[model samples]
Target: MIDSFETDEDIVVVTEFVDKQLYALINSEGPMPEELVRQITCDLVSALFYLHSNRVLHRDLKPQNILIDALGKAKLCDFGFARHMGRGTMLLTSIKGTPLYMAPELIKESPYDHNADLWSLGCIVYELLVGVPPFKTSNFASQDCISFLQGLLQKDPRERLTWPDLIYHPFLKGDVLVQQDLAASLPPLTEPLSDSQQLFKETQRQILLDRQPRGSKLTKFVDYFKQKISLEEGNVKTVDGEPMQISPSTTPTPDNPANSNSQRVHTSKSREKKKSKSFEPKSQTEESESDEENQVQNYEWLDYLHRSMEEVFNHDLSCVFKPPLVKVATSPLLKRNFSPQVYNSVACLLILPFITEDRNSTRLKTLLESYAESNVVDLLVQGMWTLLAKKKSELDEFDLVKSKQLSSERLLAIENIILLLSYLVYKQPYPKVDIFLNQFCNAVKSRGSSFALVTRHLLTLSKRRPKIVSDILSIYNHIIRILPSQSLVVLEAVIGNSATKAKEKKQIDLGKFLDSPNAMLRLNTCVLIRYLTRKFGASPYKYWDDSIKQKLVRNAKEDTDLKANVAAGLAVEVIKKLELITSA
Candidate 1:
């Protein structure tokens, strides 16, 4: 198949247009052409040999997935379930593929290798040569085909003919060059879509919402229809007797003569207020004019921080496009096991625009209502804390990520949930003194967040739980640059100030902060290390074995961020001078 760069406009795969499928040719056209079958089988074997030699397995190998081009050449298509096995990897356990063409090992749910594809090829080849396939379920006696079928249709995968063996078959070894053009043999294909036609369809899709909203509702329901009926899943479809609605991302352009109001929904009547060129937010009470304000009323005000938060002199904090509206549902959604695709759609609409750390939330309640459902907060508080509190018997976060026991897809689901909770708790300050806040702080010390919703909250952990301390330090390092103001609070709490005891035991180790997949964390931790060194000096480094000290020093110097490198230079200089020890 042909390929293209990763742009948004990929509709269908661009491949060599084949006139007909091998299955259609066999069924519709009168009789099998032995010579043509030989050529097709060679092509099929060639594709499989390339795949198996590279330790790949095409789980599905039915005749319908094979296409015959007008050039009389065959090609394989539809590798939706293909997998790449590592060197010395013995078998795959996931049960998938068409049962009719499935190998004996697959049907028995036994672990099998790439040789499974060869068994399916035996079934197809037998059916192609003789009118019927020789199987336990159905068979027709054929003298010539029996030996070839016997060579491949093995109950044990170990006994199945490998690709190297199959290619040397007597049927394929014979030089039968009898003429048969597949294009002439099969019926003509339907006309292809013109460029103009393809463009028109895409334009229509992009310019308007789908014609049927219920169609999407049905699609959502169909995803879990079995559970919807049996388990009776609950869906939040309406608010105050009105249906949930999704809004168009962009409004109609100035050249369009039709009323913009008529063309699409405004989502909120407050949206009709004249937008400022500087994007200054309208007053919180501006929603008084909105008809639906009484039902879904929300108060919104801009809270700006200087853009100096980035580099201490970047610029002024800029605009708010409109009052942020947390889109609940324009259409219904399956709440259970939500996929990343649906999560991204929500992020684009409600979260991403306002994610800048420079903005502040005055009220956590108002923020949650504007962005997510009421239950999500409860789900966030309960579901996430449970995962965070999981005692690492032997597994760390990286171990969870690279788990061989669970599918990669399942690992993503767990991480997504944890990340969702982090977004929920984002921007809300960690209370310096509160019972409920203490509970949360303890969780942060255990396993805070694995996602990028940087929290402004700084936890002052006095308890000596090693896991919690490690995770809290990770969060502090991750978000130090994102929220420099709060980061200082963290440093003060952990590293101490001038009035503090000079010989306090180091509460948290900065070395565990390394090896984070988040590159920003590495740079930020190095900055914190520089700050810590100015307070504690070279004493910490001197006590450590050479490798630990070398690693800490190398990290600061080798950091990619220019600002971090500068910080490292200052840190290394202070440590070398042993100023704290000399002065004391």
Candidate 2:
């Protein structure tokens, strides 16, 4: 598929068009020519070889599932039943695939591997060559054809032709030329929407909304325009049974059309007074006038709403358009027994099929209303926190050798949920202090390693969404009292800030911070050393030598900033105590 996107009413998948299915070609021309069949068989075998070599099984491999282009090139389609046999996966017990093309082992509900697909390929090949499957009639055109059919149609899977031998079999040996892998030829399935593309998509959606039928509820501005025009023409009661409110000075006549919108703001303020007074059981004529006033106000409000929405949608969308670095074909929602409970939660599962983040909440809110059982606020915040914690854990446990592309995909998925959560939290009406965040902090305090992971993840996220920097600092500040050593990674940024003009290195030298001219940097460095002293005692001296300790002692006595002197003095005291203990 080229791209897939979800609308309020439908989910659309875009793909390249093919001429016809193999089933259609076979039905139209009784039996294909041997040469044509040879070309197609080569294509099928080449496709199967690539799949089986990669440990994938196209469980459903019939003629109807194959597509042919005008160039007579055959392509595999409909991987709805595809399965990947990962490392150590010996057999798949699920009974899948169409009955007619099922292997003998699959038919008997036995365990099978990628070889099951080979049996289905044999059935399709016989049908393509003879215009009917071999099992339907025993009659054979030639001895060689019979021999080829018998090798594949064996009752026992052990006797069936394996993928390696089938490709080199006499029927398709010379035909198996090196063919290009389908995936390598196609563009990426999904790409990040550039600024221009985001604007274009917004304009396209608005145009679609405008083209909807006038009376249909889908057309947001159409019916309102009709009502507004009718109200000005006939001086009738509005849609809500109120008489039209037209101020004499601002009213538009055929000759005075220019004055209509000039004093709209003045008229609205006057109408508000009239509306407030009308709330106290006014006469029928007065009530009608008030309702008509509300209709005009509603129309004006909608006009403003559309204008504001246009400004928001057309603004720089790059900050929000975070496409996954690694895209997976299927959503995690469809898979069972997946890790990181965040992916399986109600909020994450709901938005997995759509874009990472959307500013407009109409669709998301509609989905929440439909799919979410409990409170939307609770569901979203809880899921976001769970994902944040898992993200930290994944980063902390990174192993270059063991981490596959799925690990990258998992991080992207977690970020996708986070991006959506940020938008939702900013837009939705929820309490300022979320209970979920409090619970997360409490969990981190209980597990010191979790504090390291959480703080590291938040620090990484703050770089992307700068608005979350305060939250990161808040969590780091509060949690440090309970776990000091765990906050070492986050404090490294404090030391790194002092070395802005210097060449970057993998590890920042903490000693450099003590010699910096900036008093705040020197102060934070003292605090960091104090934390290290509290955590590792005199052990830090082994790595830094006595120069770092001398700098701290000098800062305690001669630093310009008094706070730095006090912090450095405290750090020195801790180091002295650690030194005495070590000597003893």
Q: Ten consecutive residues with minimal summed lDDT in candidate 1?
A: 298-307
In Å, residue 384's CA in model 2 sits off its true spot by 18
Q: Over the full model, what C-alpha lDDT does candidate 1 score relative to the true structure? A: 0.42
Q: Report, for all candidates in order, the number of backbone clashes.
A: 5, 2
Candidate 1 colliding pairs: 244-330, 245-330, 246-330, 445-468, 446-468
Per-residue lDDT over 287-343 for candidate 1, one digit per residue giving the tens place of the 0 to 100 score: 111222221111111001111122112222222221222213211122322322222
lDDT of each: 0.42, 0.49
Off by over 4 Å in 2: 1-14, 136-138, 178-584
- Candidate 2 residue lDDT tens string, 1-584: 89999974457899999979999888988676666877797898778877766657788889899999989989998876686654333345446678889998887656566668778888887888788765567564456555666787787775777755676788775676544345553221112335775465455344333432122221232222222222232121222335433222333322333222121111234433542111111111111111322322323333433332333234322211222211121132322223332242222333332232242544544443332222333333343344443222332333211211123223434444444343332232233543333343444445444344333344333222322333233333323433444455344333232432233222344455565543434554566566656665544445466878888887787775555566678778878888898899
Leading candidate by lDDT = 2
Worst window of 10 by summed lDDT in candidate 2: 278-287
TM-scores, all candidates, are 0.36, 0.33
